[model samples]
Each structure stands twice: as C-alpha cells, then as structure tokens.
Target: MQKVTDYFNKPLNLLPNYFKKIGLGFILASVVFVVSVKISGIHPTAEKKEMMKIISKDVVLLGMMFIAFSKEKDEDELTMLIRMKALASAFVYIVIFKIVSDVFGIIDQELIENKNGYFFQMMIWYFFVYYSAKLLR
Candidate 1:
C-alpha cells in the first residue's frame, strides 16, 4: 500500500517548458483557421464541416495535452503537490458535472455524445483549478 501510494504520488516526467509555447501556437492556429473559415463565408458541405470540426477539435486537444504535460518554469515539490490537487479537483468536478447533467438533463445530448467534448471540458476544468490555485497560493 505504501509503495502504491508512493507510485501514485510520484511526479510525472513532464515535457520541456518550451512545449507550452508550441501548444499555445497550435491552439491559436486552430482558432484562427476556424474563424477564417467562418468569416470567409465558404459554406462547406456537411461532411466537410464535420471533418473540419473533428480536425479542429483534435488539434485543440493535442495543444491542451502539450500544455498540460509541459513543465512549469520552476518545477518543484509544491508545484507537483498543487498539480495533483488540481487534477483530483478537476476529476471530482467532472464526476459532479456528469451526475448533475444526467440527473437534470441540463446538458445537450449532442455534447454528451462526443467524448472529445467531455475530455476537453475536463482539461478546461483542470486548467481553471490549477491556475486559480497557483494564483491564490
């Protein structure tokens, strides 16, 4: 049990800090592409639109993963502790969101149908918690 706890508590091998900038670039590019397409008024066929959406979402997810895995400028014990706490909080938030949405039917069925959206929401929640905790501390 102690070993298991230690393993779980171990800090992850994060990517280089520079990856955060690359991730931001990816996210910005995706947003720009989408906005450009929309503003250009080039109405693609339904299939094309769906493909674009999937691609854009994938790019955004990739960017987010990069950002999440990249190390902070000063990676230390406190930051690791805060990261873990933020992750746990985000997980709890997702569970609560799922339960409440299911019980109240507040969320759109379409959004729930897409796992990418669900995972994206989790990432968003994690960032929110992580940044807030860092700032507050």
Candidate 2:
C-alpha cells in the first residue's frame, strides 16, 4: 500500500509545459459547448440537455484535474507544500460556498437550478487558487 501510494504521488514530467494550454483548451471547449447548445436552432430534448450537462461537467473537471496534476517547471518540496495548501484552501472554500449556495437556494429556486454552475466555478477556482497560492507563497 505504501509503495502504491508513493508511486501515485510521483509527478511525471509527462505533461511538461503544455498542461496549461491543454487544460485551457478543455475549459474553452466546455464553454463553447454550452454556447452552442443555447444557440442551436433545434429545441433540445430533455435527454439531449442532460447529455450536454454531463459532457460540459466532464470537460471542466478534466481541465481542472489536468492543471492540478501537471508537473511544475521546478518540482521541489516548497512547490509540493504550496500545492497541498492550495488544495486544502480550495476544499474549505468549496464547503463554505456550498453551504451558502444551499441557503440561497431556500430563498430562490433559480439558485438550485444553477447548481452545475457552482461546480464549474469551483473547478476554475481550484485551478486559479493553486497558482495563486504558489505565487503568494
């Protein structure tokens, strides 16, 4: 188990310098997908809308995951610590956001309907927060 954990923890230079671009591309693709769905002349059936939602969610999540796991140019103890801190911070923020959003949902149904938007926002926040913490550290 320890060996498996260690292996999983290893950051491969596999992503190199292109991780950010690839992640950004995924994010953009997610946005474009939603926009296209909205603008398409065909009235979206319930199943189609659901499918699009899942696809968009997957795209955003994949982008964020790519960014999160990507190897930095300088992979050092300090960078790893910063990454861990950012993850902790993002988790806390997500919890708080969810609670607040839930409270707002009691006041407005629209808030509940837009729950997926919160997920997308959280992914973006995680990506930015990781870099921001690194820079600030």
**Each model's TM-score, in the order given?**
0.84, 0.70
| Model 2, span 36-129: residue lDDT tens | 8678766788998888889898987888777777778787878777777777777788789889878998998777686666656766677687
Model 2 is weakest, by summed lDDT over 10 consecutive residues, at 11-20
- Candidate 1, residue 122: lDDT: 93
Clash number for every model? 0, 0
Q: What is the C-alpha RMSD of each candidate to the true structure, in Å?
A: 3.4, 3.6
Model 1 lDDT at residue 38: 99
- Writing each residue's lDDT as its tens digit, candidate 1 over 57-127 gives 89999999899888999988888888989889889988888887676565466545554567898999999
Model 2 scores a C-alpha lDDT of 0.77
State the lDDT at 83 in candidate 1: 91
Question: Which candidate number would show the highest TM-score if scored against the true structure?
Answer: 1
Whole-model lDDT per candidate: 0.88, 0.77
